[model samples]
Target: MKEIYSNTQRAILWLGDYSDTAVPSHPNAVLSRGEVKAAFGIAEDLAADRHHDTPEDREIAEGYRALDALLKVPWWQRIWTVQEALLPKHAVLRYGDTEMPFARFWKAFDHYFAQSYRECCGEYWLDFTDTSSNVISCLQTAIDYRRLLSHDQGLVFSVLISTFRGRLATDPRDKIFGLSGLAGTLVADYSLQPKDVFMRAIRTTITDSGSLAPLLRTPEPDRAKDLPTWAPDCCAKLGPEAQHSWDMVWFGLFAAFDAAMGTKAAMLNPSAGPVLPLQGLLVDEIYEVVVHGICRDRDEFCAMARRWQHTTETVAKRNHGVYPRGGTYKDAFWRTMVGDMILHEFDAQGTGQSRRAKASDEANCRMLWNPNGDHSMGVPFSRDRQFFTTRAGLIGIGNPGPKVGDAIYVLLGGRVPFILRPTPKKQDGATLLEYVSPAYVHGIMDGEVMKEKREPSWVHLI
Candidate 1:
C-alpha cells in the first residue's frame, strides 16, 4: 500500500475480500460479503437514477437504504486502503459480483448526504428517523476521506495528518509511515523506526515548513510521555468529542496572514535533531486557566453566555475599544470556535421546544449544540472546562492542557499565536521553549496585535 504513494501509474481498486490479505474484520460489519456484493449492484443502479428531479418520497427512501447498505463494507475504515484507493489513476470498486466507477459512487453518495443533512436539520418535510445511524456515520467518514484527498495538496505534513486523524490502523506506526509519500518533502526520513517516525515527521515539518500549523491539532489523550508537548500523537484516536473542523476556528488567523509561516528551506543545521530553533515574539504569558462548561442545561448555557460577556469586557478594556463591531465580541469568539451559522432553534426565541435539544444534563457539549457535528455554528465544548487568559490579560480558548507560566507568542509566518511551555533544556546554549499548542486569542488571532507595532524577536521552542 505504501508503494501506491510513489507510483503515479494507473491502479485499479479491488474492494472485495482478498483471501491472502491478513486485515482484521471490522466490528461494524453488518452484512455478509455476498450480501454486500449484491447491495452494491442495487446501489449503483439507484445512484444512476437518483437524479430524477421530481422523485417520489418512497423512491428516495428506497435509494437511501440501498446506498447505506453498500457503504458498510469493511474496506472504508482501513488506514492503508486510503492512499491506495484515492491515488489510483482510475478506479472501480467491486464487491462480490458487482462493480461501479468510484466517481459515480461518490456523486450518488453526495446526493444522499445532502438529503440526509436537510432531513436531520429539519429543512426537509420528511422525517429523518427512517435512515440508520450507522449509514450516516459511514457516509461521513467516506466524505471526509474524499475531502482529505481532494484538497490539501500543498499543506504542510502535520496539517495533512490532521485531515485523516480518525482513520484506524492496526499498527500505530503505520499511521505516520503511511503518509510518508503523500507528505513528501516534509518528511526527511520515512525509514526511521516506527516509534521515531512521528517525532521526525513533526520536527522536520515544523522547521522545514516554518508554519506552526501542526500545533493546531488536538492531541490524543494518551500521548506518549516522551513525545514533545508540541507534537501530536497522531496514532491515537481523537475520540468522538474532538472538533475535527478546528481549521475553521483558526481561519481568522489565516485571513490576516493569508497563509501559515514556514519555509521549505532549513533554518538550522540538519545534524541538530529533535529540538527546533524558532524565532517569534512573546505576546503573553498565561496567568489563569479559565474553567467553563458545555451548554448542557439552561444554567450551563447561561454560564457560557456570561463567559462570552466577560471575555468581551476584557478584550475591550485591554485593546482600547478595538473589537468586533455590530456583533458582540462573544459572537466573534463563537465564530472563532464555531462558525457563523446559528441554529435557528437555539437563537430564535419563542419557537417552541426544538426537537434537536438533548435531554442529558452532563457536560456532553457536542450533541447539545453541534447537531450537524461539522463544527459549524454552535459547537459544544470538547471538555467541561477549557484554558484561557495569560498573565498579559490576553483571553482566548485553547487546547485543554496549558497552565500558568506557559507563554503565548506570535511566530513569524504563523497565522495564529502559539502557547509554549518552557522546557528545562537549551539548544546549543540558547534558551528553548516547549511548544504547547496554537491558541485562539480573541483580539490577537486576527492581526489585531500586529496593528499595535509589536516588534518580532526570537523564542526557542524545545
Candidate 2:
C-alpha cells in the first residue's frame, strides 16, 4: 500500500462510494464540483444555525452537513490509508458531486471547524460536527508527519502510537504493522501472537531511545490483552482527558511537569525478557477510588455535581468544618475532580468563550452551578478516568478504575505519575508490580513528589 502511494503521481481518495453513515441527498446538499472549489475559497465563518429559520443560515448549515458527510467516510478511519494519503505526491478527495484537492479542503475546514476537534476532542465526544472536524485535523497531522519523514526527523514509537491510536484495522496486528513505515519497521512476524508482536515493538522502542518514557504514556488498561502490563498497548484510544495526552500537548515531554524533576530514565536492557526494571519514588497508596460515567445530559451533570458536593461535605465534616487547604473543602473537591486541569468556562451571563479556569481554580467552587445548563460546564474528565483518594489525604484521578492499595509513583524521566498494583507474586526475589494506569494527580503533577527527600528505588514491573 505504501509503495503504491509513494510511487503514484496523484492519489485519488474516493469517498463517493465509502460512507460510514447515511447522508442527506437533498437538493440543498448538492455541492457541485464548482461549489466545492468555491467552498474551499471561503475564508470566513459560515453563519450557520441549528434554528435554521433564516434561509442564509440554513444554506450555510446544509453546506457544512454535506462536507461532514464526506469526512465521516470509513476511508478516513482505516489505518493503512494514513500512509496512502501521505506518501503520494498529491491527493485528491472526492465525495458525491464534489472533488477538491486535499490541501484546499484542509484549509477551508481548518478555518471553521478544525479547532473544535484539535482542542476539545473529549468535551465533544457526542457532537456530530466535531467528529468530522477531528477526522480532517488528524489527516492534516498525517501530512505534517510525512514532512517530518522527508526531513529525516524521528518521532518515538510511543508518540506515533499515542497520536494515531484510534485508527482502526481489520486485522488487529495491522495497528502496529500499518505504522511500520512511519515508526520504523518492527520485528514483522504475523505468525507471532499479538502480544509478542506488541512486546517486540516496545522492546525495539526502548532499545532505540534508551528511555522508558514510552511507558509514561500509559494506554487505558484491558486492551491488547495478555501483553505485559508495563509495556504500553498501542491499541488504547487517546481520550481528551488522557493525562499523558494533555502533558504532551500543553507541556512538551519533560518541559513543564517532570515528576522525575530532571532525572533521566535508567537505560534498562530490553533483552532481559518481559520484566522491565525501572527507577521511581513510591509516593502514596490508593485508599479510595471513584469512577463515574461521562455525564450525558443536564441531569447527569447535576447528579455528578451533587456527588462532588457530598464528597466536599464529607471532607469538611471530617476536618471539623475548617478544611486545611488554601480554600474551602468544596473548592478542594472541585479542583481534585478536574485534576486541577484547564477548563473552558460556560455560563448564562458570560460568553461561553470568556476564560479557561486558572490552574488552582478556587472560584469554581460554585462549579456545578451551571445556570446555562451547558453539559460541558463541569465535565473536564470522564469516560476513562476514576477519582481516587490517596492514603495521605491526596486526591486525584486515575484510569482503569484504580483499585485500593495500588501504589502511585513518579517514574524517573516520566512526564506524569503512574499507579502500579501490588501482586502476591514475586519475580527474581523482587516484589512484582502490575501496571494500573497513568494518572493526573493535582498536587504532585509538578515535581512535588520529587521534592520529598525520598530516594529512588528499583521496582520490577511485568
Could you estimate the TM-score for every candidate? 0.69, 0.71
Residue lDDT tens for model 2, 330-400: 55666655555544533322112213346455555354445454334335443234677676656666655
What is the lDDT, from 0 to 100, of the residue 38 in candidate 2?
A: 41
Model 2 ranges off by over 4 Å: 1-62, 86-91, 94-99, 114-163, 183-191, 206-213, 216-225, 232-256, 312-332, 343-361, 368-378, 382-384
| Candidate 2 local distance difference test against the native | 0.58
The RMSD of every model to the true structure, in order and in angstroms, is 8.4, 7.1
Cα-based lDDT for every prediction: 0.52, 0.58
Model 1 Cα shift for residue 9 (angstroms): 6.2
Shift of residue 111 alpha carbon in model 1, Å = 3.3
| Candidate with best TM-score | 2
Number of clashing pairs per prediction, in order: 12, 0
